[model samples]
Target: MSTFLNLLVYGLADGAILALAALGFVLIYKATSVINFAQGEFLLVGAYMFYTAFVVLGLPLVAAVLVGVVVATLIGVLVERFILRPMIGEDPISIIMVTIGLSMLLKALVQMFYGTSPKSQPAILPRSSVEFLGATVPLNRLLVILIAAVVLTAFTIFFRRSRHGIAMRAVADDQQAAMTMGISVRRIFALAWVLAAVSALIAGVLLADISAVDQNLAGFGLMVFPVVILGGLDSVPGTIVGGLIIGLLTQFVSGYQDPGLATVVPYVVLVLILLVRPYGLFGETRIERV
Candidate 1:
C-alpha cells in the first residue's frame, strides 16, 4: 500500500508537467493549426536561461524565472512572426518540416553556449522531503502539483471569463468566422504563441527543479504527444485528464513491471486511443460527405 501511494504521488507530479507542456501544443494547434515540433526546445531554452540568470548573473530567483519566461516568450513570438507567419496556408507537412528544422537549430544553439554537460539547477524549491499519504515525497514535487493545479484552474477561468480567451475559442471554432467578427486572427496567432511559450517555461522550470538541466530535458516534449492525443488535441481539460492517466500508467509500469516499460507505455496508450477513437477523448469529430 505504501509503495502504491508513492507511485501515485510521483505519477501525479509527472502528469502535471506533462499536461503543462501539452497545453502549449494544444493552444497553437487550436489557433494556427500548427504543431510546433520545437516546443521541447522552448523548454530547454527556458531552463537554461533561468539557470544563467539565477546562477551566473546572481539574480533573485523570482526575477530570474520571470526573465526566463520573457525570453522564451520572445522566442515564440519571433518564430511565429518570422518563420511560421510567412508559411501561413502552407501544407501541414511543410510546416512540420520547418518546425523540425527549428528544433534542431535551437538544440545546436543551446549546446553551443551551455556545452554538452548537464548542470544542476540552483535549488529553487524546498529540498526537504515530506511524508504524504503514506509515502515520503519531496516538497518541491508537492509544490509542482499545487502550482500546476492552480495554473490549470486559472486557465479554465480565463477561458470562461476573459475576453481574449473567448476570442481564442472563437478563432479555434472558426477562424474565418472569427476574422469576420473582427478577432484579428493574426494577433490571436501571436498571442497563442506567447501563451504557449509561457506554458513551456513553467513546465521546464518545474522539471529542472526536480531533475538537472540538460539536453535530455527537452525529451519531455515528445511525451506531450501522447497526452494531447489521449485527451483530445484541442481540449484543455482533456489534456489535464490525459496527463494524469499517462502519469499513473507510467508510474505503475515502472514500479511493478520493468522500468523500460514506462518509457514505452505512453506511445502504446496513444496507439490504443487512436485505434478506438481517432479524434481523442474530448476532441471533436469531423465528418465529410462525398
Candidate 2:
C-alpha cells in the first residue's frame, strides 16, 4: 500500500542517519575499548558548527561543511590526546565517568553559546516530493539515503583495503599482537576518534537538514545506544542492519499506532535483544577460560 511505502522510505532515511551515528560509537569502542558517552554531543556540536558557519557567517554550503569537518577532527584529536589519553589504563568505570562528564561539558558549552532555541537550518536538500511505487517520498529523504549509502560504502572499502584501515582492524583484533606487528595503538586510537567525529558530524548535519537544529539533537544521538546494541557493539556491519531495523520499526509503529509509542519501541526492543542475545545480532561472542 501507499502508506506502507511511505513509511518504508522514511524508515530507510532515518536508519541511514542512525547507522552513521552508531558507526562512530563502534569505531571508538573497537579501537580503544572506550564507550564514549559523549558521542551524542559530538553530533550536537557538529550540527551547531555547521549552522554557525552556513547561516551565521554566511559561508557557502561546501565551505560550511569543510569547516565543520575540521572542527570535528580537532575535537576528536583533543579529546583523545588530553581527556581520554590520560585515562588510558584507568578503571573502565572511571573512563566511563569521564566520558559522561565530557558529554555534560560539551552540552553545557553548546547551551552557553547557542541557548536552547531551535534554529532554522538552511535547506541543503530540495524540499520537494516525488512519487515512488505509488508512494509520495520526500526528495530530501531519498537524497539522505543515497548519501548515507555512499558514505558507508566508501568506509567499507577503506576498511577492507586501505593500509591504515587494515592497521586499525589489526589493532582492534588484538592490541598486543598489533603492537608486536609494529602498529601504533595510540595512533590508531586517535584515528578512530577522528573518524567517529567525522561520521557523527555528517549525521548531525543530515538530521538538522531534515529537522530543526535544537538541543534535542543530542538526545536523538542517544538512540545510537539501542542501535549499536542491536547490531553488535563491535560489529561494523551490525550498525547498518540494526539501524535499518530500528528505523523501520519506529516509523511503522508511529504510523499504525500512537506516535508516543514509537518513542518507547526502541528501548523495548533493546531490552528484548539483551535478554535474548546480549552479544547482538552481529556481535562476536568472547569466551575466556577463567
Scored by CA lDDT, what does every candidate get?
A: 0.89, 0.94
TM-score against native, each model: 0.96, 0.97
Query: Could you tell me the lDDT of residue 153 within candidate 2?
Result: 89
Stretches of candidate 2 exceeding 4 Å from the true structure = 287-290
Model 1 agreement with the true structure over 67-119: per-residue lDDT tens digits: 88889879888988999999998999999999999989999999999898998
Off by over 4 Å in 1: 286-290
| Residue pair clashes in candidate 2 | none
